[model samples]
Target: MSPGKTASLQLPSFLHGTYRSVQQKVKREGLRCAEQYRKEGAFPSPRQLLEVPLGEVVVVQGVVDIQHERPVWRLYMVSEVLRDVWEALDWEDSSSVRDAYEASFLETAWGALFFTLARMGAVSAERTARRLEAVLRFWDPLECARYLFKKPGAAQTLEELMVDSCGWAMDAWSPELEGPVRARLESAAKRMERATREDCLEAILRQMPRALAAGHDLKHRQVLADPAFQRERLTMLDTPSFERVSGACTSELLEKLYDWDHELGLQ
Candidate 1:
């Protein structure tokens, strides 16, 4: 509803929240900071970034404090930020991505920005598709899983990824995940499914003591280890939400990862 944001294209559910998040951020701070850009002439409306050319829109780095920085947005060129996101956000593999969920909200939001504009038809179809491919190249089950849980904790950004990854942003598009990437995602899902079973076993094993205190051990809970969690590959959930794991439910991704009925692990 901010001025110049009157583009009638209804943002898809997958992207609406992030679009709002960025809008809120602009209203809160960018509005004040953007005045500098206004004087430069030809600056696109900062309030409605979707109005900017896909190649032109730029976002602040997650590590930046816009309040302190004179320039609210990064000095990085649109080309650089776009390339840096995928290149820097890269993990060893799905297992690598699943292990720590290393990509940060500030980082992944770039992907969401592009994804939203694409889904909303804010940009041309060909360009959106091409841009999304690079961003999503870094996405996986763990990537999508980032948003599967409640956004209240440290996962607000992750929830945003879930919108892009699982909320039909990828699935409902004209050209679904195709060619090498689709194969790559399937392979990643397979690995994560097996790994999660192992993850669950360890998590459940660590919960044996609590079950005993309750005078029963019949049902073991899924739990993460202390920061000292020694799995080497993964550790317990940290900070805002320790009780939950990022990719736990993602084990259920595509409903094809695990043989839940017969192979609940524990062997």
Candidate 2:
């Protein structure tokens, strides 16, 4: 079959220069370029590529054009991204997801270091990045776990793997899992100092009482013990006068707090 036609995107005024030629060249060598890009770790998801308008003008050089040796090439690239996302949804393996999260952390850390050192005039961005890269060369996940958690859990959570990568670690909690979730994650960070991928996985399934206890202890102090931390302030002092409840409201609130007796442990 003949190769697919070169698809051109309309460019915005800002992207008027050389974009057409670039797209054509990119299209002409689409498969080769894709392979090279993957080898160099430029994994643009197929969904992301398709989001680009084929003939749209560039507001910021924004357009999506794809030329494939065969339609299957486009299909294949999309399949990979779908596969990873699907696995995450299924809560399976979860390693690739962890890896992506870890990589993001590294990017944040590298960026932060780059700016900090650059501002201090201590090192060039290039040199600072190089040094960070070098440091990561000898970085081992297990060693990190052991160091961080003196009483490390046998298993680390998905976020624990990204402890060194602060950005990824920061994102480990979802809006749904924000409270006790953080304490569990901190526990994972502690584990990362010593545990391996295998060790970490095993520990979770075992549900080590020690691990849970440690996580709960941390969470109590960090998230729950102080009512101040749990209570949401609805109004400001300057806005309105609020009624102070001495009896009924206080009693009701206390009952609600301990209502789920046994389930409190699970929470």
Candidate 3:
């Protein structure tokens, strides 16, 4: 296909400009090499044609774009797309293709790093706390357990995933707030671990209020100490909109959070 037509057909706008430029360069170079081989009365293999250093082109273009932009969400979306592309490319046996996939994967990691750093600078501790509470508010231990158990030879239980998720939330906060949050999460994990399989979800749900209460206390203390860290008031979407005591609310919110397919239930 012509370069312009190929670009329009194969590349999304998010990956246009530099990405298209590099792709066109690689395509031209590869075609030139193939034409030379064809004139020599020997057709080159597909692998030989793809032997051009496409990985370097992709990496250079991606790095330049990353440095020029500061949108974390865009970076995240690009990273996810790159990851999918990398996986899709894995079926190819060529070393050059493998190297290009690796380069794409590295770019994905860079995107994630940029996103984390951006969020660290832009998001406030209070906002982080509220987001954490929102996640825990919809924490469904039954679904977690079911998913984990369904996985063959699962290393960590539902409690571990919950605890680890909570720990990740601590990363968005100041060091002072970590102690209380970690303690509460650990305590919750231990409590859930001790529960019977049938009652595990109930045990986890029961801890939600206490976790939120502790989070609020710690958040208040952090805000009092560093008023600058206090976030502006949140909109309805930023915070959970249901009473803590409502199980039905928690179920609905969890369904939304996990993006459960209505036809398949929680997959």
What's the count of clashing pairs in each model shown? 1, 14, 0
Per-model TM-score versus the true fold: 0.24, 0.19, 0.22
Q: List, residue by residue over 85-162, the lDDT tens digit for candidate 1.
A: 224334224333222121221134343343433232122223333434434444432132222122222333423543
Give candidate 1 misplaced runs (Cα > 4 Å). 1-28, 41-118, 121-124, 137-145, 148-267
Local error of candidate 3 at residue 180 (angstroms): 1.0
Segments of candidate 3 deviating more than 4 angstroms: 1-68, 71-82, 85-179, 193-195, 204-267
Residue 214 local lDDT, model 1? 43
- Candidate 1 similarity to native, TM-score: 0.24
Candidate 2 minimal-lDDT segment of 10 residues: 239-248
lDDT of 2: 0.28
> Model 2, 242: alpha-carbon shift in Å?
58
lDDT of 3 by residue, 22-126 (tens): 344445434543354336523232231121111111221132344333321122233333233334445344435433333332222222222322222112233
TM-score of 3: 0.22
The numbered model that scores best in TM-score is 1
